[model samples]
Target: MDTQYTALARRFRPQTFSEVVGQERIAQTLRNAILENRVAHAYLFTGARGVGKTSMARIFAKALNCPNTKDGVPCNECEICRGISAGNDVDVSEIDGASNRGIDDIRSLRANVNVRSMRSKYKVYIIDEVHMLTKEAFNALLKTLEEPPPLVKFVFCTTEPNKVPDTILSRCQRFDFGTISTDNIEIRLSQLAEAEGFTVDQEALELVARRAAGSMRDSQSLFDQLLAFGAQHITAADVHRLLGTAPDQRLIDLIEAMIDRRRDAALSQFQVALNDGVQLEAFTDQLLNYFRDLMVAACGAEGVQLLSVGRDCLPKLQEQSRRWGLENVVAALQIFADTKGRMQRVTYGRALAELALVRLSLLADMERLDDLLSQLKAGNAVVASGTARPTSAPPPRLAASTSPVPAPSLPAQKKNERLTPPPAEVASGADSPVTGSRDPAPIEAAAPPPVIAFQPGLEAELHRLMLSRLTDMTGTHLAKVVSTAISGPNRLDFSFSASYDIGRKACERPEVQARLESLVKELTGQDVRIQFRTVVTEAPEAKPQPAQPTNSRRKVVESPEDPLVQEVAKTFGIERWLRQEVLAEVVEAPAGGDLPEE
Candidate 1:
């Protein structure tokens, strides 16, 4: 006969509150409840999966019903205790809420609620995943739950407590179980491995514990699967292979490439990971978690305890964190997070992964605007993260022309030169005689305009600087400017077509003018006024034509003396202008010199 093999998870189930791992608080509370005889009629336990909610429920049930209970702990030797541990106890029932979640099931359970216990002080009813019960079923259990028989006690367990109705929740004592720490889970695995006589590396156990993500059952189950490898000794390489996870070194190399902004190197490392059979989704997820750790490291000494990695990797992580500033780390996290979601929706996830890698690599050179602003506000030079610019460096100036446009060949103004303006009264018109023969009031002296050593491209450079400073409407308006020139020593003029009246007006805005003036000061180191003017070119006037002759409109009569009549007679081969009256005289005279008809 062959022996049946029991899985580690089932073989190692906790039978007593003291044996339950990673839930000491709940266990102690339950023990106090039992010791004080204050156990509630209905109790609710909630937590993430594999965090001992169900185990705590069963242990509590055993403690309540065990005949040989000691200090709220059940003696595993007794028949009733063994029966409860084996899940065959008559007085203590363990129900699967998922399987029997309808009103009929609740009805049947309710019908049995009043029956006396067969052999225990209290009949404990434990329902796992109580949130799975339907609305009607919950309603059916409410009355019984709120007012249960003195001998009946109910324990409700669920991972999703939010799904449980408030009415049901309000009637029970609720205890929330937290996830087991990685160290605790690792320790448990080590103990299991030693008991099973299988040698396992410490790192391997850590890998399994971390992979469990705070679930004790998951860790045990994973360890069991690893044991099936049939090897007497387990290693980290084997765990990595089984989980399809990239080695930490590989992940570090890949991150280093990204930190250095070496896209090709990062892509190559990613390909290597793929070649090593690492799933793209898993790889992206791991990268995101790595950045999360980097964020923790960036927080400095206070976060060292919060790191998931061991001390061996701490120094490296801190170095990487320094290289990738907090801002860049956050940006990388966002990029990878988005890529992770996209990879799930597409068949070709490798492309998204590669694109994310490229984006992360490019992030090395990028600086957050807010960071720069803060630095500037602090009186520090706004340098990029990886750059070596000095803290006290001045703002980069635009390169000036090597040979500035030569100053006009005029006598250089003396340092104390002053220009006097003529009196307004005399300046209006010298022809106007003074009404009172009083000498014109002494002219008020005015400061001479500062002369600038102009550059040929000064206007162009100022325009460029202004364009860089302005945005949106102002920038658009500045773009339509046809030309820029220095109309006066202290006045910069911008010319536009007359058709662009609106644009010129936009440029005349006070803010726009102020920005232009500031740019001028920045470029020439002198105060300059800005002026906007429109240019219109008029078309040439048409010349007047010579006056027409006065007699040109006269009408002409047909006569023999007319040249036109002679030309017509000669062309037709007949006498010129042969009159009808002449023919009548010639014919009538022959016939008695009288006309035949009037």
Candidate 2:
């Protein structure tokens, strides 16, 4: 092609290392090697596309063969330079590795590698997309790659360095190129626009730069297209119009509305953009980029490089980042991404996108389960029943009330009754004024009754805790038998059966005591000492007394569910257990007395 009609990427191809853009480090390293007379046998160039990989390879080949060189730069005026620039030279071969990937091609190259250079001091082989070579081809080229003739040099350029085997990687001197910054690409585009006699908004150039995504050739190609479309001058609006997408301002407005939870405003903005023919998926993509900018802004100044937004966008993004935490920003991004994915399959893409918009707006109201349960007592074990696991909804609340235990020596019933509070209505009824004299009794002022410090409920607590948890502990006798507890000022004592000597000893361990004490403090907010003692059982002597009927049996009577039992039944929801009763069946009773129900 004529120079005047050639594409920008080919027209501006770098003829030397210095002419290549955004790869100063790699270029400088190769230049230094040449200046030091220390060139490697094989060179591997790896990086993203349009980031100067193949271009750098060509420059290296030119610098190696250029007769008139200064500071490792090739004189483009030389016949060797012109020949390499046009990709036609006797001593230099630029092979496309994608097409010539077979073992036969490699064998043919290997055969040609031994031949002397036709003209230049060295034969340079530039293999582009070298990773596309077949496994057999790679294996066939390995020996030649490892020990090529001193008259020959190899340059391998590939975007995917990882696809190349480590065996091959170890044989070459590798240099990785990075994506060109948007600022760098913008600068280059502006320079190109000036060279091509056109004018464009700085923002317009930035759009093209971002579209390029750090590939110089790609940026140049896009700029060439935009220039042809806009002729002499293009503004940022012109770029957005040509791209057939909503303007950046529209996206920014929609997100700001969502962040502030102005649902109506956001909806109107979205509808307007849709009516204006903006693509839903493309709008979602823009929203993703917008949220990404916000997330990076939330990360503070250190993460600024992660954003692709420009100068005018930074302040607004920073302001919006303060409206929501980084977590909310991340959640919004995820919702938008899901909406975009669902848009591909669903007919009602608009409704799905709107749902995502509403979800993002309501992210502040969302609560995690841990936060929801933070107010409840942690000691209350809410275990999931294996047979009753819920498929969708949350698991049911299963709470087992602490069962009362009988102390061997202590009046366990009355003592435990003192620990519990009485029924609200009954106590209030008892406090009601009686139908006696209205005059108050005259007496000296007296101190109030002392407050019980330790939790007597702690005993039932210890009992239920032991049954549910310690029954599985090996060598623990505390779980083998029923136990009881009593509160004495600041002390809580646990009395167990004498048969559980082993379990009692296990409870006596210091670590076990400390652990239980911590658990007690958590349960009752008390730090009282815990005493584990065995209740002794004495053998009773047989004494003669009045004889009773051998066949007569009586039904033992238990009181109705008291207010505390009712309260417990309502609170922990163990009503069925509280309602159960064990009865001694009555035989046929003598006449006159009402017979117990069968």
Candidate 3:
């Protein structure tokens, strides 16, 4: 007889509290509860899927019901422990809330709560996906859940605790199971591999662990899939091939090409990756992950612990991060992220990816505005490197000045003119002397900007300023004003249309009134009062309709003499009096009322 094969996830399931990986704190809490004889009536285990919520629940149940339990850990050799482990125990029941999630199911459960346990010391109920229960069902189970029998305990598991009611959450002790870290998951995978006699590469194992995304069961499942590759030795190449991702070296080469502004080389590398069966979405995902590491590396030694790449690749990654500066690295991440989004929404992923690559290549000379400003302040001319694209004209020089005279335009100035103001212009009392130069006149404080007098278009100017400063909603509210008039020397009245009731109410808010008052004071040289009024336009009177004669009524479409009615009645063997009575009923019914059917 052939033996049945079990999956790695199932074969290596955690049996004891100590065996449960990545959740030591939770396991310890449950064990302490059992040891101290202070187990609560209800427990709420919440977390992402496959993080051992169900496994923890079962372990807790076994610990509570096992006859030979020691130090809060169940001895799996006993009959009751074995039954619970196999999930067929009579005393402990595992219920899937998704299937049995109605009021009737809760009623049945409530009815059986008072009964004595079949064999174990306690009757434990483990409900998975408890958030799927209906509102009525949850309400029905509330009282029983809040105050169950002393011998009965309830353990509720959910992936989304937000969907669960706050009432239910308050009645139980909640334990949140966080995702296993990459290191912990990798260690667990190595243990499993050693037990299974598999010679897996450390890099391969790390790749699988990282690919799991902080789920132990997910990593174990992925490891099982790799075992089917029919080889005793598993390499990093196998992991990349299985995951449909480009190799680390290939991705590194592509990034280097982009950093060097070699557009053709980058495109060639991208094409090669695609041709090697690297999926577009996967390729884009790998690029995002690599660039994320680059961003961390740009943070210097403090972020070295956060890197996901192998030690062999860390030095190269740090070098690349330096070459592609932090600003450019961030820009590249945004580009790939947008490309990934487009790939998810459309089928033309290759085109979007190629466009993103070209855009990244152009960012080789990208610099932050602050850096450029610092360079200019230090009297250094900002020059583009050879890798930067050529322009028809050189960039204009920028210099700060407080003089009334404006800087000359490029056409009016010579090819190599200094950016400093001329000595003739500086000698005027209006201009300040240049930096580090001996001045003939003492430096004076710069004069304030001249304020213009109130003009006819003052309201228009205020409205423009409001539009620039306020949000779209507030600006729209202000725009709904029908007209603005000068009610007094220092007061402006804004009239709203009758239809702009909401807008008028919005403008009447205290904050909006204060903002308008400040704008008015700023525009005019004095405190100005702003008033908002609504124009109550009278609605036009509705016209009276001409009366119709009482004799004119809706005629009945069906009659006893109608051919179709007669046919239907005769076909059903209807009597003459029955047909007459039906017609009378139809005719006597109000025009708006529905007719009766036989």
The regions of model 1 sitting more than 4 angstroms off are 301-308, 368-598
lDDT of 2 by residue, 94-149 (tens): 99999999999999999999999988999999999999999999999999988889
lDDT for every model?
A: 0.77, 0.72, 0.78
Q: Could you tell me the lDDT of residue 43 within candidate 1? A: 94
Q: Predictions ranked by lDDT, top down?
A: 3, 1, 2
Clashing pairs in 3: none
TM-score of each model, in listed order: 0.65, 0.65, 0.65
- Residue pairs with colliding backbones in model 1 are none
Residue 439 error, candidate 2, Å: 53
Model 3 TM-score, all chains together: 0.65
Best by lDDT: 3
In the range 417-449, model 3's lDDT, one tens digit per residue, is: 333311111113321112212222342323222
Per-residue alpha-carbon lDDT of candidate 1 for residues 283-388, written as tens digits (9 for 90 to 100): 7777878888888888886444433455578789989998788888888888888888888888988888888889888773355444444433433332223232
